[model samples]
Target: MQNRFRANARFGGQRAIVALMLREMSTTYGRSPGGYIWAILSPVAAIAFLSLAFSAFFHTPPIGNSFAMFYATGMVPFLMFNDIQNKVSQSLMYSKQLLAYPKVTFLDALIARFLLNFMTQLLVAYIIFGGTMLFFEGTLSIDILTVLDGLLLAAQLGLGIGTLNCFIYLRFPVWQQMWSVLSRPLFLVSCTMIMFDGIPEPFRDWLWWNPLVHVVGLVREGFYDGYDGYYISSKYVMLVAMVCFALGLLFLRRHHRDLFER
Candidate 1:
């Protein structure tokens, strides 16, 4: 029975993937009052609040008139990562009933959650960007392509971490809670609100080694031309993301059966 079920659990075509993603999306936010609107609004509000708070404390603009823009670029991707991690960590427990279905593999849940968060993040980022550009008359550039590239990198980073966490959650349920506690402070160190250039040389070098910092630096490069002077290693970021992805897949493949039992 287990072998047969595994055989039937391979990823299906685009149509099946789309249907599964939609089902997961609806199940995730549809029961609430605002449903999908809340998903969009919550991140926007958080970014705005963070921008305001930081703007006051720093006593200087973080990114010129584009402080909100800077914050949005970082916040949207970080929130997407956090959301995917949270959703994927609990995916097995939430989809325990659906696991009985032959088509709904453990991977499908992770993929669906990742896709949903990716789409939602992209939508929110664009909306905020567009509104800021129009209303605030912010500086515009032809670097939109770079922004897209950065978004892809962010998505890869999120998907890689989220997939690994799925396996960790299945193997050790306590890891989910532990991860939440550890990730909060790490967000501050991620160079989301502050530019890599702002840090002292020694700490700046250390922050440059962080993959999340590279991701943010890449996004900033797309937004501001001068940002390339900072120390960002896109190759390092990609390598880290790829390593996480490969290890996560191996872990999942080896322990998939264990997930079903738990």
Candidate 2:
């Protein structure tokens, strides 16, 4: 009987998550003119612009022969991190009204947004990366496993950080703007275009601690055969993500009521 009840609960949760995802798709994208196409185009357009703008400045991209490949590898992982983090962090605020019902909980909101956005970003990455490689006739060897690993790492980190930030943002609204401002520099410094080894000494030592740098390095390692991302430590990235996720759960469990009231 207990097992049956547990199975039913799990089924119900899956149904709720699917419902939330479909609602989000309809409201967030369906209402928009282009709908799902926008998801594909947004990243494609960004990479195109980055590749074109940087082609002159970088005769040789940090990774492969094609400027598009280099930027896509870097940008896609970074975008995955950025998008998932932002979406998860805002899940509470976005679904506050729905949370009033007994059927929905904060976890449901987080899971819904996390699953939807992660899959969307993953699809976008595959399309943009695969298309760029075919179009440019990229000579570099693409390590599919490493690319997936990098993206998975980015998603995990994003979920952890965003979960923590969700509670923080709820308790203190101003922190949202503050975090936005603070994260602005991340785009420039996250090795979106530049290689980790390319950075001069001393700085590389400090920048190595930033997880996104390692994530970008992993993506680049997958894209380019000769390039080595020996500096990346998956353990370190996993550690940071787990710690943040645990802390977020701790705080949220304790203070969720206050957040809901606010």
Candidate 3:
């Protein structure tokens, strides 16, 4: 009887997640004109502009022959992290109405949002990276497994940070704004388009700790065959992600009801 009950609960959770994903698709994208296409175009346009604008200043990209490929390697992972983290951070508030249903718990809301956004970002990365390789002078060879590893790390880090931020953003509304202002520089310092080793001194040491930095480095290492991102510590990235995820669940389990009551 206990096993049957557990299986039913698991089945119900899957149904809840599917319902939430469909609702998000309709409301978030369906309402908007050119809905899903916008998801691909927005990132593509950004990469194109960045590639063109930076190419003029520097004779060549920091890594690959094509500016597009180099930036894509860096930007794709960063965008994956950025988009997933932001979406997951708002998951609870997003599915608040649905959560009133007994079968749909906060975990369902969190997982639904995370899964949708993570998959969307992966698709975007695929289009951007694949299209770049076809049209541009990208590296001849690629390491698919290495790229997958980096992308997975980015996804994990995003989910972890997003989970933690969800609780904090609800508990202290001002933190959302503060985090926005503070995180703006992440794009600049995360080594999205720059070579990490070339960076000098105390600044490099500080950036070493930013998990996103490690993610970007791992991704670039995947794209460029000869380049070794020796500084990247996958274990460190996983540790940070696991720690944040654990703390977030602990805090939310204790205090999530407080938010619902408000």
Candidate 4:
């Protein structure tokens, strides 16, 4: 009886997740004309613009011969982290109405949003990176495994931070704006456009704390064979991500009822 009950619970969770995914898709992508195509285009356009603008100023990229590829290496992973984190952070708020149903859990909402956004970002990354490599001449010396590893790290970090933010966001309304203002400098310091090696002085020591820096560094290391990502500490990034994720879950579990009542 217990085994049967477990199976039924698992099946019900899966069903709830699927339903949330469909609802998210319709609400998010359905409103737009192109639906998913805009997901591909938005990143492609940003990458192209950054590549062109930077190429004009600098003769060559920080490491690679192709600016588009160089930027894509950084931008895609960063954007993936950005999109997934934002999506997952908003999951609870978006699905609060559905959570009234006994079978629909907060976990289901979180998973549903994360899965849909992660898959979409993964597809976008493949298309953008593949297109850049194919059109550009020369050897990028791509290591597929290393690249995948970096991307997975990025996604994990996103999930962790996003999970934590979900609780904070609902609890404190002002945090939403505060995080936006504070995180603005992340793009400049995250080792996206600039290599860690190029950073000189005590500032480099401080910037190393940002988990996304480690993520961007590892990703660039994958794309550029010659570039060594000595600064990337996967362990450090994982620690930060895990801590945040755990705290987020704990917070949600303890206070979700209070929040729902409010």
Top lDDT: which candidate number? 3
Q: Which portions of model 3 miss their true places by more than 4 Å?
A: none
At residue 73, give the lDDT of candidate 2: 83
- TM-score list, all predictions: 0.87, 0.96, 0.97, 0.97
Better of 1 and 4 by lDDT: 4
Q: Write the per-residue lDDT of candidate 2 for residues 1-262, one digit (tens) a residue.
A: 9999999888878887888888888888889999879988988888889889988786877656788888888899999999999999998888888888777778888899999999999989988888997898456677899989999999999999999999899888999999999999998888887888889989999998899998988988887887888899888888898898888888988998787875
Candidate 3 displacement at residue 109 in angstroms: 0.4
Residue 255's lDDT within candidate 1 is 83
Q: State in Å the error of residue 242, model 3.
A: 0.8
Look at candidate 2 and give me any clashing residue pairs.
none
- Model 3: lDDT equals 0.90
Candidate-wise lDDT, in order: 0.73, 0.88, 0.90, 0.89
In model 4, pairs of residues that clash are none
